[model samples]
Target chain A: MSMPEGRMDEQTIAMRVAREFQDGMIVNLGGGIPSLACNFVAEGREVFFHTENGALGYGGTASLEEADWDLFNASFQPVTPLPGMSFFSHDEAFAMIRGGHIDISVLGAFEVSEKGDLANWAIGNMKDYNGDVVAWIKTGRFPPAIGGAMDLAAGAKRIIVAMTHTTRDGSPKVVKKCKYEITARKCVSLIVTDMAVIEVTSEGLVLKEVAPGLTPDDIQAVTEPKLIVADDLKEVEL
Target chain B: MNKVVASAREALADIFDGAVILCGGFGCVGGMPSTLLRALSELQVKNLTLVGNAPALGLEAQKTAARTMQVPESYADGSLLLKNGQVRKLIASVPAMAIYRLQEPFPIVKALQEGQDIEIELVPQGTLAERIRAARAGIPAFYTGTGTGTLLEKDKEVRQIDGRPYLLEYALKADFALIWAYQADRYGNLIYKGTSRTFNATMAGAAAVTVAEVGGVVEPGELDPEIIVTPGMYVDRVVVRQGETG
Candidate 1:
């Protein structure tokens, strides 16, 4: 199949996702592409960045010269403290999340179903038997780690999945059904991918925006489920 | 009364085999009680059940230092216990193996692959924290919507709260808690620096014996009672790390 030209990059995808942020919203950015959205929030908008590790309202990551070992984000990178930043225990931090205080949670997913199901934590690796590849096993080879993703997905007021449209091997990430382990069922509200921006609605997966030169048909070529083009679908804007 | 102990080894002398330990930290050096973990590793206590956010903790510190070029004084974490074969089970949110570095399995994963008697229970990070908090607060169980319709709800009691499914999670109490703090008074009132307070403050009163590894110990009145994160009532013992001023 011929692919569309001018796909968005990780930064562009993050920039597109950041547009969803609003003033006074308490946002939690998960690992990978979701974490980049913290840097792209619109200027003059007051957003509180909550890291599940402990601190809330932290600013951008700290430089090596200004690094403080005790202060870091959920990704384990040293972060700079903001004026209103406050530190709490893990229980309090998770309470803020699981108590439905967080306005939005942008998470990175390996697979996001058309029904809004999320599967991002673990992937089974292939095992060979007698010089032939056998089954994709999860037990001994790849034990899945279910971190705060479930809590955030299930507890946050809104869940937005930020990821590339396709896997590294050119497989569709936005699928009819998630084959891997599910993080949460029908929790994702918005999906911002490198190829297209889709919203999980009551009707179906609604195609909201596509990459600069790509069309809805081009996005459907890669997506596993059929796309419902929005009434005002437009090219993805930064 | 002075709760200060001379060393980590002395503070953890009562830790026996088959003990349940709540180790504090978010997989980084600042929050981890490295001095106590190092002493625990050297003590060679076996069959420990560790509860924490990250099971393979020190590796994150090493990775962080490598990336930022700011090496901590010590990198001891739960891996030391796993390496010594002292941990029989790990109850944590993150796996023993680094999710990023799946090619290199940690000792816990290796033992599991070898069919050894090791168990891993992956709990969502929030549930784990709330369970520990529930234990400390004397709550037996609580209902939460954090793990509904997921693998975490398997065999767990589920009830509908406000038309939403909520899972009943039990308190996760422990035999001992090893926590790190920036400063503490002789009365055991603790204060942590920055994000180092993550699990350290949570696990303080959740265990039978809460041992704090602090950088410095001061007089009771030295610490402002209003600013102390953990009151002395929760902390049973306090040990100042070596090379740190008390």
Candidate 2:
């Protein structure tokens, strides 16, 4: 099988995920690629961004000259505040997440199971090592930082995972079951990856859109489980 | 009725060995009581158990972004305590050494690598905040579905609530709470600037002694009652930062 060509880059993947945003939606964008989605929200559509660190209705990343260490996003990047922006305590911020107030949460993942389980926090045998720091470091594995991913996964009304289809070594990231530490169980609703746009449904993983020039078979080759191709499956639109 | 202290060192003067201190902040120095942490370091108090969001990126790691960001030269965090071998354990959500300068050598990681007896308990960010808030609100325990199926659920009590599984978490309390705020009244009413509020607001009154490091202090009635994020009653002491007017 020939390797698929013209895979979407991080910016393109974020752009595709941004299309899922609706006006006036309160969205929480996790670090890494998910953070880029804020830059691609359609013009005229108003989306309020929430950070777990305690700020809502913030604008995009601030320029160096305008940077304020106190004003930052969940990614720890300085951001500009918008009119009507409000700050709250960490408890209040997480209350918005756990109380079913956030409209959408877009997050990056290490592994996403076919059943929509998320495993983005830890890797390798770090979970079972039992705090043997010397041995753990010798294995070159740093302790995983859970952050707010689990709370966002379990509480956000809808979860959209944005990641590459495969790891750098061509290993599948969309798998039958997550081998890494699970962040949350069966929480993902939509997945926008570099290779395809997939949806987690009651039936199974549905292939909704493939990157341009890639076929359903091409996507399936890199995925772990069999995919249910959508009837209206089409090329990913930027 | 005045709660104002002259300096950070005086604010934390009562901290002793083996005390459990809650340091409030998210990831950056903006939300942290940097001056207090520095004082704690200078005091050389040992065996402290720290509770917060991250383990705190030390001054060296922060220096990388100091050039482009709004970081202050006097910035410090719990890392100062860790570097001084003062912390015995840390309970936090994100325990990573340095988020930006990943390659930098962190004292906590170095101590761990050398097999120093430092313990770290990882909690989800929301759960951590809720736990601290619960302590302040006088709630002993609560059920939440945040860490039901993860490693964090190990040895925890789990119950089915509304057909969903939840882990029972006890309220986390501390001996002292070190926090940062934008302004304070002589009576200790606090108002924070921007996102710097983070854990600071939630941690007030959550500990035996809640100390606030503020940019400035105003007359008791000078601050409008409506805008105060933390009531004066929750704060035990308020310390003005150096070179700032009261």
Which candidate achieves the best TM-score against the true structure? 2
Worst 10 residues of 1 chain A by lDDT: A129-138
**Model 1 misplaced regions, further than 4 Å:** A1-4, A125-142, B64-66, B102-104, B243-246
lDDT tens digits by residue: candidate 2, B1-246: 899988888888889999999898786667778778888899968999989997465766666655566456777788878777788987887766323555655656766665667777878999999999999999999998898787777789999988999999999989999988999998889999888999999999999999998888888888888899999999999987753211
Per-candidate clashes, comma-separated: 0, 0
Please report the TM-score between candidate 2 and the true structure. 0.95
lDDT of 2 by residue, A136-180 (tens): 533335556789999999999999999999998999999999988
Off by over 4 Å in 2: A1-4, A127-140, B64-67, B97-101, B243-246
Name every residue pair that clashes in candidate 1.
none
